[model samples]
Target: MKPAPFDYHSPRTPEEAVGLLAELGEDAKAIAGGQSLVPMLALRLAVFEHLVDLGRVSGLRGIERRGDAVWVGASTTQTAILRSPDLAAAVPLLTRATPLIGHFQIRNRGTVGGSLAHADPAAEYPAVALALDARLEALSPRGARTLPAAGFFTGMWTTGLAEDEILTGVSFPVRGERSGHAVEEFARRGGDFAIAGAAVAVDLDGAGLIRRCGIALFGVGATPLRASAAEASVLGVKAADVDAAELGATALAEPASVPSDLHASGDYRRHIGAIMVTRAWRRALREALDA
Candidate 1:
C-alpha cells in the first residue's frame, strides 16, 4: 500500500530541521535514511502530516573521535560504519553488530541514529549501544541534551526523545587496553531479525580475573535489556572459571518481560536468549584473554 498524502521537506541544516518540527507540532516527523519510517508509512502503520527529511542536512553526516568516545553522526549510514576502520578499532562490538543488521542494501540506506530512534527491541544497534553505555544526543528548541543509553530507551518502539527533539548523534565510550567485545545473535535465516541476541563486553585484569563487564540482550524484552544481574555474578572471578551456560541462564533468568509473538514463544525466546548469551560470553572471554 502507498503512504498517505503528506508534505515532504528537506532541511539544509539541523537548526532548520528542528525549527520545522517545533513549528509543525506533533503531526510532523523528522526522517533520516527512510529505512524505518518509510516502511511504516507504506504499511499504514504510521501517518504524519509532514516529513522533515534530513537528507540535505550536511551537518548530520560525519564520524569523529572525541577524546575517549567515538562520536557518530545521526545520519551516518550503517555501510559507512562497516567501512570505518577507526570505529572498528575503538569499538569493535559496533563493527561486529553492523554486519548483522539485515542485508547489505538495507545497511547501505539505514542510519545508526534512525535505528536507535526506531528502537526495535530486536535490532542489533540498540543492544550494542546499551552494552557500550553509549551516550545519545538529542536536539530541541530548548537546547541540546545528553542521555545515557540506560535511560534513553523507555519501551518497545519508544524512547525518551520529546515530540520536537531530534537525535543528533551518539558517543560510544572507548574501553581500556585489556578490554574485548563480542556480539552473537540467533536468526532463522541470514539477514533476518534476531529471535534473540546478545552483545557482550569484558575487561580483564593482569591475572585474568574479571575487572568489569557489560552484557546487553535484545529480542527477548520490550526494550534492549542490560544483563546486569548476570554481569554481577562474575565480578573478580577468574575468566576461565565462569561457566558460560550458567551465566547465560542467569542473564535471561529474569527479564522485565520476554516478548511472545508468532516468531517465538517467550519461553523459547528466553531459552534462545540464554544460548546466545553463552556463546557471546565465551567469545568475549577469548578475545579479552587474547588481548
Candidate 2:
C-alpha cells in the first residue's frame, strides 16, 4: 500500500519546523528518518495533510557533551550513535542498546527522536532512555521545555509531545568511572523487534557495593517500564554477594499488566521479561566489577 497524498515541507531549523506545526496545527506531522512514520502512512494508520521534514533542520543533528551530560540531537541516526566511541564511553547503555533497534538499513535512516516520538512499547531506545533517566527537549511556538523520560511516554504509540511541538534533542547523564552497562533482548531473528528486553546500568563503590543502578524493561508493558523494585533490591548490597539473576527474577515475580499478542502470550512475555532482566543484571554486574 502507498501513503495517501500529502503536502511536504522541509524545514532547515527547529524554529521553522515548530512554526509550521503551530500554523498547521493538528493537520500536520513532523517527520525525521521516516522509518516508523512511513510504514504507518503506507498502511493509513496515520494521515496528515502536511508532512514537515526535519532532516534539514541543522539544530537537530549533532552529538556533543555538555557538562556532565551528553546531548544527542533528535535527528541523530542510530548508526551514528553505534559508531561513536566517545558516546559509547559516555553512556554505555545507549551504545549497547542501539544495535538491537533494527537491521542496518533501518538503523541508517532511523533517528533517536523518531523512535522516542513513535513510542513503540518494544523499541530499544525508550527502554534505554527510561533506564538512564534521559531528558527530552521540545520546542513549540509558545516556548521550549524539557521532559523527564519517565513522563515522556504516556502509553504505547503515544507521548507527551504536543501537536505544535518538535523534539529538539535528548540529554543523558554521563556514567561515572565505576559505572557499567548492558542490554539484553530476545527476538526471533537478528534484526526483529524484541519480544522482551532489558537495559541496565550500575555503579559500584570501591568496596564493590552497588551504589546506584537503573533497570528498564520493554515488550511487556504499555510503555517502557523502569524496574524500580529490582533496582531497589540491589542497592547497597555487595556486588559479589548479590545473586543478580535471582534478585532480578524475584523483583518481577508478581504478574504485571502486559499485552497478550499473537507473537506471544502475556504469561510468556512476563517470563521472558524476567529472564532478560536477569541476563542484563548479571552482565551489568560483571561490567561494574571489571570497571
Candidate 3:
C-alpha cells in the first residue's frame, strides 16, 4: 500500500520543525525514523497533508547526562540505546528491554521519542519509561511543557501530545548504587510483540530493605500501568524477603481492559501478566542483592 500524496519537508532544526508543525496545524505530522508512522500512512490509518521530517534535525539525536537524569533525544534509535554503554550503566532496565523491540532492523530505525509518542500499550519502551518515572518533554506553539510518564498515556495508541506539539526528548531518573533493573516478556516467538511483559526497578537502603520499587506491566491493559499494589508490597522489605507470587497477585489488582483478539483472551492475558510480574519481581530482587 502506498501512502497518500503529501508534501514532505525535511527540517534542519527542531525549532524549524516546531514552526512547521504549528503552521501546518492539524494537517501536519512529524516523522522521526518512520518506523511507526510510515506503516500507518501506507495503510491509510493516518492521512496527513504535510509530513515534517525530523531526521535532519541536528540536536535531536543524542544522549546527555544532566545531574540525576539522563536525557535522550526523541530521534535516538533503539539500536543506539541497546549498544550505548553509558545508557546501560545509567538505566539498565531500558537496555534490558531494548532487545525485546521488533527486531534488529526495526530497532535500528525506531526512535525512542517516537515510541513514547506512539504510546502502544504493549511496547517495551512505554513500560520501561513508566517504571523509571521518566519525564517527556514536548515543544509546541504554546511553548514547552513537561509531563510525567504516569500522566502521559491516556489510552491505547493515545498520548497527551497536543495537535501542534512535537516531542523533543525524554529524561529518565538515574538509578542509584543500590538500584537494580530487570525485564521479562512472553511472546509467541523471538522479536514478536509480547503477549505479556513486565519491567521492574528497585532502590534499596544500606540495610537491604527496599527504599523504592517501581513495576510496570504491558500487553494486558489499554495503557501500560504501574503495578502500584505490587510495588507497595515490596517496600521496606529486604530483597531476599519479597514474596514473588504474592506480589504477582497484588499486581493484578486492577487488570487493564484487554482486547479479545484471535490470539489471546482477556483472562489469558491477566494470567500471563501476573506470571510476568512475578518473574520480573524475582529478577529485580536478584539484581538488587547481586545474587
TM-score to native of every candidate shown: 0.98, 0.97, 0.96
Assess each prediction's global lDDT (C-alpha) against the native.
0.92, 0.90, 0.88
Model 1 over residues 1-291: C-alpha lDDT tens digits? 999999999889778888999999999988888888899999999999999998788778788999999999999999999999999999899999999998999999999999999999999999999999999998988999999999788997999999888989999998778888999999999999999999999999999999999999999988999999999999999998999999999999979678789999999999999999999998999988888
Candidate 3 — which pairs collide? none
When sorted by lDDT, best at the front, the candidate numbers are 1, 2, 3
Report the number of clashing residue pairs per model.
0, 0, 0
186-210: candidate 3 lDDT, tens digit per residue: 9999988888889999988999999
Deviation of model 3 at 52, angstroms: 1.1
Per-model root-mean-square deviation over C-alphas: 0.9, 1.2, 1.3
Model 2 C-alpha lDDT per residue in residues 1-291, reported as the tens digit of each score: 889999999988888899999999899999999999999999999999999999999879889999999999999999999999989999989988988888899999999999999999899999999999999999999899999999899987999999989899999999987888899989999988888888988999988899998889888888888888878888999988888668668655643677888888888888898889889888888877887
Q: On TM-score, who's better, 2 or 3?
A: 2
Per-residue lDDT, model 3, residue 93, is: 93
Q: Give the winner by lDDT: 1 or 2.
A: 1
**What is the alpha-carbon RMSD of candidate 3 to the true structure?**
1.3
TM-score computed on alpha carbons, candidate 1: 0.98
TM match of model 3 to true structure: 0.96
